[model samples]
Target: MIISLSPRATLLETIPFPAVTVCNMNGAKKSVAEDIDQNQSNDSDSLFEKHMLRKLCRDNELMSGSKVNASWSKMQNFMVKVSQPCHTMLVACLWRSEEMPCHAMFNPEITDEGMCCSFNKVKRNFIYRNPRQLHGLNYTFPYPSIDWTPESGYPPDAPANANPWRVFGPGKGLGLTIVLDAELFDYYCSSTASVGFKVLLHSPVETPRVSEFAYFITPGDEARVEITPKISTTTPDLVNIPESKRRCVFTSERNLRFYRTYTQRNCELECQSNFTLQECKCVPFYLPKDSSTRICGTADDECVENVKDITEKRLPEDYKNRTGWEKPRNINCSCLPSCVQIFYTKQMSTGKLEDMFNVQKSFLGGKNLSYYKQNMAVVHFFFVENYFTSFEKGEIFGFTDFLSSTGGLLGLFLGFSFMSAAEIAYFVTIKVLFSKLRKNQRKENITQTRIFKSLPFAE
Candidate 1:
């Protein structure tokens, strides 16, 4: 039997395999005409070679570069667990007319900003995804599958789920009104140097960093954020162009190994993780890294801090002049921005909660309204209007336009068009032959007239 390999195989792959295929020669050999099939699993040497080959392929991951993928896993194995529970952070929650329990409303996620309670950011498969699988599942955030994207909004026939799902505009009853109980007494060191909750609206695909971007909602004051959903997308026509040439990657074009959905923030985070790994030899606990990628411990704290400072600090060289004689961030990251992006821009309005306390008391089950007014912050999240301006990136001169225009002529033949080619053909062949035929006909007529005139004397 002849075994053929693919022509596209590299020079290294052209080598003959020393390992032999294991095939049964008993019953199959009895029939001389029958073909024998070999099982690859039975070949111990072949199996070992394949396994080693796979490991060798992944060996390059040890090196550092931009656009490198960072693994993102659950924070269950980390030493830090349950620093601050969701119930403690969010005392009360209200979305539209429905009231959600503090524990069930938000899903817990670990970030650089410490304990985070994510709202409407969990996987649709599970209501509350328990970090430890042995503990079993909990239906804390009992909602339908979120089928919304930057390219496509919520389905027209989607289930009536919650505030974000419903798409309600600016109104007290229609939006998400949450009363935050900022337990400032237990505060040790405030990162923002203020006593209040940091309110942030970001893509559900992204990990929210409090230090990166946030809007502070001070305690005892009601802050209403008039959300204006911003969307930026590249035209579908640009999909044919190479990602490297376009300088932007579509969701399907560049997929992150850790993230299910690709976003600009996700790309940057992944890039940062790889850069950190390159400089410090280990990545931060918060960054998305696989088990193989070493987690930065106490020993690597200094290195990690230095890397963070380099990335976070605003430097003219970072943005203004990329090319320099010697740069600290030489190979920072070759990450291209995502073709599509969605951001929630908020316009906040603040006022003392003492004035809006009487009506909110009933929502709190008639508890100590006077006490909550002093310690609580009611935040409302709603759309400012039904319509908002969104940006779209498209090709100015498309392929079809080029083919129809003078550009196509230059591509087909140097400095010549279809009209010019047609004119040349007419003059060189058709025009020359037609003129010769007319001249020959005229000569034949003249010859016939002269012959007739000479023969008239005989008639």
Candidate 2:
């Protein structure tokens, strides 16, 4: 035992430690090291998560679908189809009701004297009741207004000063379908000895789509208005997309003068109203009429006729040397449709009805059909399949745009990042203020020491 022991051996022999306990202690140390490694990995993962969240937020700000850029080159495609019955049927029967008084019948007692009576006579009876004596019948029903609904009845809830017979249907179906009944047509023919009807086939789209139609009939006799639908497809050079999404940048304000919002229909309507005002000294009741301006009435028929004549007869040569504001030699009011084009091809047939039958048992009964024997025509109108087609234009910025913008900003301002911005804020709000406060305190202390020295007193 007297053998020389090294310092390590002597230290181990002095401690009352077992080998198994030392092994267990070493295992505990390994476990602690493993926990430290896991913590480091978790910290790296958290940093990665933070970076991803920041990138996502930035991407959402730039690529959110709320805003769009204006561009002229952008384009969108639309396919519209309208399905309708091949043989369209329009039953021209009198819409009659007791509520609607007959102004055509004259009082026998009042007219017996053979004296001149006032033109504005009292309507004492209903027109349908005295069908035999329907000479002075006025078949001109008032046009329906924009808000007019058939559910509200014949006389709509309208303003007193508003025009009557301003009949306007809401809107047509995108792909419209219509069915024709031969039995209904036959019933209309037998129900009235004579009737008046006009069949019009036009695009369901509002104004600026196309004002003209193929089939037009004047009030009188039983007739058939047939349309062999033809399509005139137009792919406009320019297109309109939603303003909320994108808009045209190159178009001038003067070019879009008619519409404040720049829609084809609005522009056309505005142009028409302006033309009417210039020619007739009044706007049509159907068009927008200012309160100061009078609406065109029956009295203004002559002016309307004159305007129509001027529009139809003037030649292009006559327009030479005239200013743009000056009325064109031809009363040409050109309002081009936007990108959408709708064309209707029409054909017609006509015939006469010999006898009359009871219309109360027909489909036209509940609709309040009024009869006028002088005008008789069963007009049918409908659209064919694939009736409408539209094209739109729009613009957008993609992820590449966002990356390019970000890179540009970064290149333009080197060393500028969120950390740099935070540092700047800290400098301005905390570091600068602390420096100023220390400087002021130093100055104040110096001043106090000088005052003490100047007083020549020590406490």
Candidate 3:
């Protein structure tokens, strides 16, 4: 008997082996049929051992692929839940005790905290994939910009540059007082299952991520934050080095596609968006991406997470199990941090609020403190000082400063300025001319006197 293995061997539990023929051991009356059958069976077992293990691996891959496809399937379930709108999240916002329009001061933004309002954010050109499809979208919010940049200073048209900082709206005192509502009823679906808000203080150039870092402000407690500027300026010499060697991008090198500035956070956001789009065919709304790109919804959560896991290289299981040496490929962004990084250090103090009787009547809003206490949190965002000393060497020591400093040093060490040296030259020239005139006059007088005395004059 002879066995021949077919090409398609994965579906069957057993595969036929290659043809095998038994030869006689003693060359006299050897067994033909039963002996050949036994040899073929042995060969089939060997083939199963060699290829069955690989077939099992292929099965696992197919199963994993099915999961990925299922996650990518169309599901209409993920309608954006705008349970917390701007008016809902922000109960009241005050600039130095005067209640200002919250909608005017803040623009409705999307963060991991879900439907957040951002204040003092730089204006960016953004578009939603499905703007009209989103219900409860705030159409009245205004887009704002400081008209500021690292390369160029603040707007020059504004009168008086005394402050040298952006702390004007609330004057020299506390900046803005904000009351947040952490609706406790919505906690069932949240991962944290807590009553609070995640307060993140970051630059206007960056898109804040709740996954990366945040400070939690619990409900019913007032948090007072005194912000001090933490700034580091880069010298102009660093610009000469290549970006690969220096590992930091400068203001002049704003190479980012979506943002006007190139920050490390922004670069990472774009990198993540592209990578996620490559893996999952979509990107999250918070990421800065092209308008044409598809936005991810609730159904794509698994694929997004898998892509994140792949980028993070959190595949130690395969290594530990020694399971065929398969590992996730990490996403390489090759993004470097910005050379000029502006940060703020905040000193915060918290205190519990008094109950309904002691609480102010304005905050009560005809509703008792029982309703307010379960949902409200107040934050005092203030500047620690009126002015900050930022030693931006890029703007300092220009051609004019260099000339002025050189001349000042010459006057200081050598005791002479350009004007003083010019004055000395003028005086010396005038004195020399006067002395020559006097010599000529004396020579003429002497010659006349000698001639008069030697000749027939009356002496």
The numbered model that scores best in lDDT is 1
Candidate 1 vs candidate 3: the lDDT winner is 1
Q: Residue by residue across 1-459, what tens digits does model 1's lDDT show?
A: 111111221121111101000100011111211111122453543332232222222322322221221222333322122134456556667766577775655666555654456666535232212223211123254666554544554566666663124443446566666666655544433445466666667765466665567667787787877776656667776787777666777767665656656677776777678777876787876677655776554356455656665566634254433332235555445567677766676688898866543555534433466656665677777665555565676776655666676557674677677777788899999999999999999999999999988875653
Q: TM-score for all predictions?
A: 0.63, 0.30, 0.59
Local distance difference test scores for all models? 0.54, 0.31, 0.53
Candidate 1 overall lDDT versus native = 0.54
| Stretches of candidate 1 exceeding 4 Å from the true structure | 1-82, 124-140, 146-157, 162-170, 291-293, 310-332, 355-359, 362-370, 402-421, 424-459
- How do the residues 206-298 of candidate 2 rate in per-residue lDDT, one tens digit apiece? 221111221233333334333233222221222243322232222232244222232344455556566667866775433433445554533
Error of 1 at 404 (Å): 3.9
* Local error of candidate 2 at residue 430 (angstroms): 66
lDDT of 3 by residue, 326-413 (tens): 4436456767767766666677899886683486655554566887776677778876554554533233444567888888998999
What are the runs in model 2 whose C-alpha is more than 4 Å off? 1-195, 205-269, 276-281, 296-334, 351-360, 363-376, 383-459
Query: Candidate 1: which pairs clash?
Result: none
